[model samples]
Target: MLSLTKVCAGYGGFQALFEVSVEVEAGEAVAVIGPNGAGKTTLLRVISKLIGATSGEIRMQGASLARVPAHEVVSRGIAHVPENRRLFPRLTVEENLRMGAFPRAARKRYAERLEFVYGLFPRLEER
Candidate 1:
């Protein structure tokens, strides 16, 4: 579960999100529908710690993520895959997935993790 309470984030002096609050329960699918410049991307970025919230709090599973950095965000079970494929476009699907296990903590169990990932999404192995 993830919850954002009165989250306000912006770039420089331009505030993109104004007191935004959102809650995502486990196994629930939520969609963020909005036109361009509606802070949809900003909200995701803030939640992922790609950018820090100027004010308000973000909690995952009831634990505060105020001090969590972007790199640590993935380890916290949060990943921000934008609406683009600039990440290793030339690499094969498995290669790209392998790249995600680059962290020192993941390298030890890379093979096991890759197998788990492929098992969860069998299509990944086909690609």
Candidate 2:
């Protein structure tokens, strides 16, 4: 589970979130809805560490993520997909997926995970 309390994040002089709080319990589903530029993506970015919370605390399973970096966020079991498809134009589709699976500690299970991904995209399996 992940929890965010009064998260305040923004750039330079502009602000996005204002004392925003959120919670995602394990095996639970949640959805965020808002108008254009309502900090929807920013909320995700903050939790994933892609963007820092100007003020607030983010916790997962009782551990604090105040100092965690962006790339390591995924290793903590949190995956972040930006608003746009962040694909590497120079990399093949397969290579792109590989990049998505970057946790070195997960290498031994890569084959099974690859199969699971392929199951979701049969065309990828064909490739």
Candidate 3:
């Protein structure tokens, strides 16, 4: 589970998010829909620690992420797949997916994770 309470962040003096609060319970699907410049991306960036929140608290499974580095975010079961293409053009789809399991902890459960991924997007596995 993930929780964001009164999170506020911005670049320089431009405050993008103001007291944004969100809670994602286990197995819950929460959609963040907003127009451009609506701070949707900023909220995610703050949660992933890509950018620091000027104010607020972010917790994952009751563990505070105030001091957690961005690189360690994934180890906490929080992955931020940016909305951009960073794939290996020569690699197969499955191979590309496998690249995501590069971390030692993730690699240990590659097959299981792959199954879960494919279950969510069966077309990817078929291709």
Each candidate structure's TM-score, on Cα atoms with residue i matched to residue i, is 0.76, 0.76, 0.88
How many clashing pairs per prediction, in order? Answer: 0, 0, 0
Q: What is the C-alpha RMSD of each candidate to the true structure, in Å?
A: 2.9, 2.6, 1.8
Write model 3 residue lDDT over 56-86, tens digit each, in one string: 9999998999999999997877767766666
- The sequence of per-residue lDDT tens digits that candidate 2 reaches over residues 1-95 is 89999999998888999999888899798999999999988898888898899998999998899988877788987878664675467777677
Clashes in predicted model 1: 0
Give the per-residue Cα lDDT of candidate 1 at 51: 90
lDDT (CA) per prediction: 0.89, 0.84, 0.90
Which ranges of candidate 3 are over 4 A from the true structure? 85-91
* Candidate 2 residue runs with Cα over 4 Å from true position: 27-31, 79-87
Give the CA lDDT, 0 to 100, for residue 6 in model 1: 97
Clashing pairs in 2: none
| Winning candidate number (TM-score) | 3
